[model samples]
Target: MALTTKGNLGPGRTEQSAFDAVHSAKRKDLWFAAGGLFVLAIAMSLLFTLIGDLIIRGTQYIDYDFMTSYPSRLPERAGILSAWVGSLLVMLVTAFLAVPVGIAAGLYLEEYARKGWFSDFIEINVSNLAGVPSIIYGLLALGMFVYGMGLGQTILVAGMTLALLILPIVIVSTREAVRSIPQIVKEGAYGIGADQWQVMWNYIIPAARPGIMTGAIVGLSRAIGETAPLITIGALTFIAFLPSPPVTGEFPFISFAWLHDGFTVLPIQMFNWVSRPQPEFHIAAAATGVVLIALTFSLNGIAIWIRYRLRKQHRN
Candidate 1:
């Protein structure tokens, strides 16, 4: 390990010395690069620990009956049934309205529209809209759907607002997906005398299916977690009547009013219970949070599985 006049030269270098230098250098560099990951792991652990503690403390209130019944003032009486139904309705409706519109707008921007002021304006505004506060979207829903349009604070309005709120994200993701398709595919479709619309519908969109599905699912997850807009629309945190169907007096099926109705959602209901002076309410909120987390995770899992299957099919 001594330096000569110019440099240290060994008669023969040990394999272990050579290995240590090579390995140690790489290990040090690797850890340096991965230092951020360690920090991320620590942060995630703290978060999950807090969530886990809350869930464990709250699991008492997370009964199947609680999931299937309406909210009640009595700690022993409350359930998430109405909120759960409303959330499902809102989510389904939002997906129906937003997915197609977002994908179309994305396709237009990336594949059809000429680059210019209008396109640029839309692009810039959309990017900005993605960053706009969720509460701002709530205000918009309150003003436009509830008041201006006279929808009267129903599930429909909340769904529409959430659809718009996450539309930009969907559009951005869809456009990126569309853009990733090789131009050669479009050219080949054209070479076969396919019209532009035909090419897009038959080839281009299918090619981008995985990415589009991923984006739409991400947007759906965001919409599912929304509480502010529903709250702004005046969600009834303790509604009875099980939120019966907007249309039906037959077959014994319960439903909701799409217009002029006060509804509840999991978050808003959880918040209401949580704000109670009882420690039980905190446990309820934690339990509700776990339900929401599970729902979100399931949505993500379904989307990812679909994408993987599609990718596998393409590979085959």
Candidate 2:
């Protein structure tokens, strides 16, 4: 009886210890989750407060005339016509130059490049580039595009600078998206006798399109708000005229002359207005901020919609 009681005591104590350990672990997890939630709530609250304030201050100035007219010295007559138009043109150029090249570079690195020290080196540099300051890119562009190549401070130069800025982001996102696809999918393609290029074109790219688009749009969102790089490249702040129309009634029906035109984007224009001591200019700056925010939100919405549609299509 004595021996049996001692054996039972050991088992009972072991069970109690394990039970206590589990509860302790759960308590730790709960505390961690609570901390994370607190941080997130604080961040979201601040963001909403700032956005609400901007909307309140800017709502009065967002009229049709404000949209159509050009920037002027008088705050009452100043508008964002040239600013928005230039922004659109520069974005068009950035997308055209960056999208294809970034995707191609990502594909080559992931699908074709031999896994070696050189490839590893390239990968590390690419990742590092994504975190480099925007100002550094501005300096690089100033030296390379503005001086070395003699592109001047034009729409083309601005576009190329932004394109370079976003290339690393797009490449990283593409590689990650491609990597997420199940290995079984690639095996199946191989089983069906599809070659590498065929598999990439027909299966891989389609599956990764959603992620690729999301990354590209996110990068563009960052680029659109950039002020330092464009300023470094000598973007004008008070342009009253529009670039020559991109579409024409001539033989070619398209014109590239606008690429060489001087430009001013929304952020720069906003900065110009905000720098003044007058209260009226401050109001105009608030209005410009509202427009910029709306444009950014629109881009983000498009990205989300694209991602959702692609995911649904893949499931179907």
Candidate 3:
């Protein structure tokens, strides 16, 4: 009996030591979780404080005139009509140029491009471009489009610049989404006599749409809020007149002239207001910030909804 008890004591001590190690690990995990939560709380608190302040100071200014009237010398009379319109036009141009091209490049790289040095080189460059600063894209656009091509400080220039800035993001997202698709799925498509093009178009694209769209919207949200690139391209700070619509009452009813016109976007307009010495203009800047935030958050919300819907559908 004494020999048996002594032998059992060694095993008991081993068990206790193992249990203590697990408990210590769990405690460490809890501490890490607590630290993460504390950091997240601090960040969220700051964001809410900013939003609350903007609402308190800017809500009264968000009326019809504020939406319709152009910027003015007087703070009370100023509105974001020209700014919003320019932003809208620029975004339209950006979407038109970026979406199709980015998706196409990504698809080609993932599906069709030969796994060679050239393909590797392209992939490396794209990944690098995704990390490049927005201001660099603006400088590139300034030199290439503005000075070289002589596009001038136009809506098209700003839109194309932003489109280029966000291209790599879309491409990378596309590759990741497409890469997630099972090879067996494509093999099944091939077994049914489907070509590469058909398989990609009918199967891969639909499967990857959710990720592609999420990235696109997020990229576009970033583009819309960007100021450095536009400012670098010498976007107008103050503008009162609206661009001519694509149609005009003349022989050439359809025109592309509006793309060439000088423009001021929301961020640029808000920056202009914020730079002034007047207290009223500061309030106006806050009001403009509210509008900008609304636009950005709306896009983000749409992206989130799309992602949620896709996940639910996939689960179903």
Candidate 4:
């Protein structure tokens, strides 16, 4: 009986210790969760505060005239027509240049490239490039596109610069999206004697489309707001004129001359306004900032809607 009592006490003590450890772990998890919420609240508060301030300062300045007229020396007459139009044209170029190339490169790396040191090296470099400073890309564009290629400080050069800046982002996103597709999906395609291209085209791409679009949205969002690369490549800050109209009334009915025209984007325009000492100019800058933010949100909203549609279709 004495020996049995000692054994029972030993098991009870072990159970008690286990219970204590679990309780302590739960306490730690609760503390960590609370800490995370506190941090998130602080971050959200700051973002809302900044956005609120911008809206309050710029609300009075935003109107139809502000959207239609050009930037002027007088703050009351100043507008963002040229700036917003330039931003639109530049983004058009960026999306055209980046999307296909990034998606193709990602497909090659993930599906076709041989597993080797060279491929690994390429992967590492691609990942690293996503984190590279925007200014470096600007400098690169200054040297390569502006000087070497003689594209001049035009919309084309700015587009190419931003394309390069966001290429890694799109590629990474594509690859990740592709990876997220179930392996069995590809296997099923292969087991049915479908070739690589067919499997990729009919199966993988459709399933991965939503993620790829999301990545493009993120990359373009970053590209649209980038000032360093565009400024470094000599984007104008105070342009008062729009790029030549992209469409022509002539026989071709399309024109490419606008691609070569000098441009000013919203960020640079806002920078120009904000640098002035006048209070009115500052208000104009706030308005410009508001427009820029609205444009970005609009783009994101469109992309998100498209992505949602794609996901719904895929699920169906």
What is candidate 4's local distance difference test score? 0.93
TM-scores for all predictions = 0.86, 0.94, 0.92, 0.94
Q: Ten residues in a row with the worst lDDT in model 4?
A: 1-10
Candidate 3 global lDDT: 0.92
The number of clashing residue pairs in each candidate reads: 3, 0, 0, 0
Superposed on all Cα atoms, the candidates' RMSDs to the truth, in angstroms, are 5.3, 4.6, 4.3, 4.6
The collision pairs in model 2 are none
Q: Write the per-residue lDDT of candidate 2 for residues 15-112, one digit (tens) a residue.
A: 87887787799999999999999999999999999999889989898899888889999889999999999999999999999889999999899999
For residue 71, model 2's alpha carbon misses the true position, in angstroms, by 0.9
Error of 2 at 242 (Å): 0.3
Candidate 3 C-alpha lDDT tens digits along 1-316: 3456444234355687887787799999999999999999999999999999998998788899999999999988999999999999999899889888999999999999999999999999999999999999999999999999999999999999999999998899989889988899888989999999999998899888889889889889989999999999999898999987889899778988889999999999999999999999888888999999999999999999998898687657
Candidate models: Cα lDDT each = 0.83, 0.93, 0.92, 0.93
lDDT of 4 at 222: 90
Our model 3 lands, by Cα RMSD against the true structure, at 4.3
The residue-by-residue lDDT of candidate 1 on 51-166, one tens digit each, is: 88977887777888878777766767677888888788788778988999999999999879999999999999998998998889888888888889888767778778889888
TM-score of 4: 0.94
Please give, for residues 81-133, the per-residue lDDT of candidate 4 as tens digits: 99999999999999999999999999899999998999999999999999999
